[model samples]
Target: MNQIITFGEVLMRISPRGNKKFIQSNNVEFYFGGTELNVGISIANFGGDVKHISCVSNDFIGDTAISYLRKFDVSTSAIVRSNRPLGVYFLEVGAVMRPSTISYNRSHSSFSEIQPEMVNWEKSLKKGKWFHWTGITPALCKGGKETLLEGLKLARKKGMQVSADPTYRSGLWKYGENPREVLSELVNYSTVFIGGVNEMNELLETDFSYSNEDFIEASKQLMLKYPSIEKVFDKIRTSINSSWHKIRARMWNGKDFKETLDIDITHIIDRIGTGDAFAAGIIHGLQKFDDYKTMEFGAAACAIKHTYLGDINYANEADVISILEGNTSGRLKR
Candidate 1:
């Protein structure tokens, strides 16, 4: 078994408990979230050896994040603390065909100021069989891009398999020259690439029709363009309302592409972190199973995430395996 190490920033996410806006709600629930950290937590919960590397603040928020990561059995020794304050975001989840809106206030965040020297890439890369990161990291700041590149190079030199989620958040990348150029460079080091259809079309500079076959074909072209990438994965979604959604996912594993049928979900408790859960499932499945059935396991893990309130920490291996074994009726088990 290969140890999976993830590098990224963790944020304190604040959102209303229900479908209330920040102005309409008296108080909001808080949860720790970040792309790489979410994946690390899920993988750790699923019995993978997982390490999370990033810079945090020396404040209470940072302490809270550390405690939360520890509870999930994620190794955080590589995480350093700075004097800066932790970043935060406010989310308003929409219902009934409305899109969820987020407001970020993460400028000069501890992770954004992370320098390449802060991490001993040579040491961190040692003994790790896999490394995972996301576009959000590189979009943080100039130094962030350098650090990510350094980590990727070290992982490549150490023969570690690398996976990257091109989670193109336009808000975060607005400071740079352009997200497309920077993201394209980072994709060169990715062996497994994950993204949404919108992100793919935007980054690859090609408009793909809404057909699954068209999306997979576009991904195939991307794979050939970046030969280092062995697998390209994406999730497709259909929203009926804020409380209900239909989600299906697919993956192109070099030779062929596979997809899961759409699943109708009602009464979603929390919508955040579902994509990271999907990525976690795919990572777990790719490492543990060879069949295309891995896509089922990954997609099932994501479905399980919608029932939880926070980013993916609440899910466990048994929950996912049960879903994968055709038990989606949501019955309680003894």
Candidate 2:
């Protein structure tokens, strides 16, 4: 299989110590995370050949962030260095009934300043079988949005499959472009679209309900508009509290709408990167698993990510398959 290439801005994630509020915590944990980078890392953890493309600051902080990705077997050769500082986001892990929150400190960051001509998209994307980008990239800046569209257009011209997870972060779309208009243009190039009824309603300016019928109708409408889109996926989470949740995966395969069994997660270690893990599983499973089976893998991967404390899902194939195979007993191996 050819490599998967992901494009986006990664940030240094700093979180308060263990369920403590930002004001109460004196210490914090740090990690490197971004929507597309998390997807790339999850694919790498599953032993896929993945490369991440973006510019980071030409400094120690950026170097440390890329080094962290290298530990997971993600290729950083396409990463460019810039004089701007690295982006940062401070996370506050929530407890029972308290949802998590993230505050961005990413203005003027390296990736936000990146231009279309800075990287050679033809060289990087032409060699890959799949190209992935997130809505977060375009929300960073006008230059970033233009660069992402340029890469997407080039990747399509080269016959590479395209996947998009249009994450709607209201905090980042401050670069003078309307979120809906910008995302509409970028999503048109995607072959596989990942988002739900709420995401669709908000990003596309529709008033769809959170029901199966509405989701299917919304996806069909999107497919009609973007003729290249073949598959649309989204996951549902039923959170009883901050620590316990049940996640179910669903998809529309341009034919039938299918949903996976809900995987109940009793104890959550972290909730920050579960969606990214789901996206990664969908990307990987589309090549390895069949149509609806892809949702099984995706939902399972998301359930497993709730067991880890970091921003990235560290579960390997066997780990996710354990959940997929209905072996969620959490037993120890001899």
Candidate 3:
């Protein structure tokens, strides 16, 4: 199996039990995850060798977060310790017509305080075949942007594939740096683009519609602008409500364009981390399957994530394959 490297923050997610709001529940459950961490964990669960690099508090919470990654066989040796507390967010899971709400308290967290000199990129990418990152990292702090840029440069020099998911969150970019300029600089080192029309528009400053024809044209323009990006994969989610969703995926590999059938989830257990799961699946499938099959695998992995609760997708390769084979009957294995 090819080894994949993921770089980002590790966050502690606190949520009221089930569908209850904080005001209605005295109890809460905590899980450790971040956008990149979730992808690393999901890829690790799929029998891939994944190492996650991040900074955590030099406290029990950080220790517990490292342990959580270890439980899923994700490597933690690259993780660093800092005096700053671990990042945290409070989640309220909603149902039916209600939507989930989240409040972040990670502005001054350990991961945000990471320095570029703290990590040796040459050693970190020694055995890595792929490197993954999201926009959340660079938006946090200057240190994060510099550190990730260093890693991306090394990964590209090593001839390793790099995947970029430029997830734009308007609320996260308080550091005065233009997201477009920063993301454009970083994404130039990536080989695969893991987002859709909105991401392209954000990076290219173009207003592209959501139509398939427009998506294809936008992808063409994106590849023309960033020649390093060889392929683009997008996950489309059609939500009927907070509890029900339909997942579909499409891709453009410079020459061919393919899309998958929608995989409907009439009941969703957890909506978080589903997109990360899709990214993980695509990264894993690129080595083991064809392009169209890889897109199907990604969509299948995404649909399966809705059946579980928490910030990570617990589905393995076999589980995703089952879904791809149309075995979503949810029957007992026995």
Q: What's each prediction's TM-score?
A: 0.95, 0.97, 0.99
> Candidate 1's error at 221, in angstroms?
1.4
Question: Over the stretch 1-334, how does candidate 2's per-residue lDDT look in tens digits?
Answer: 3999999998888988899988997888888998899999999999899999989999999889889989998989889999999999888988888888888898888888798888898777756999998888898899989999999998888888999888888877886889988998988889999889876787557899988999999998888888899999999999899989999989998899999888999989898889999999999999998978899999999999999887799999888988999998889989
What lDDT score belongs to each candidate, Candidate 1 first?
A: 0.84, 0.89, 0.94
* Runs off by more than 4 Å, candidate 3: none
Return the top candidate by TM-score.
3
State the displacement of the C-alpha of residue 172, model 1, in Å, after optimal TM-score superposition: 1.7
Put down candidate 1 lDDT per residue, 160-227, tens digits, no spaces: 88988987777776564688888888888889887766767877788888787777878877887788
Cα RMSD to the true fold for all candidates = 1.7, 1.3, 0.8
1-334 in candidate 3: lDDT tens per residue?
2689999999999999999999999999998899999999999999999999999999999999999999999989899999999999999999999999999999999998899999988778888999999999999999999999999999998899999999998899998999999999999999999999999999989999988888899999999999999999999999999999999999999898888999989999999999999999999999899999999999999999999899899999999999999998888987
* Cα distance off (Å), candidate 3, residue 163: 0.5
Worst 10 residues of 2 by lDDT: 197-206
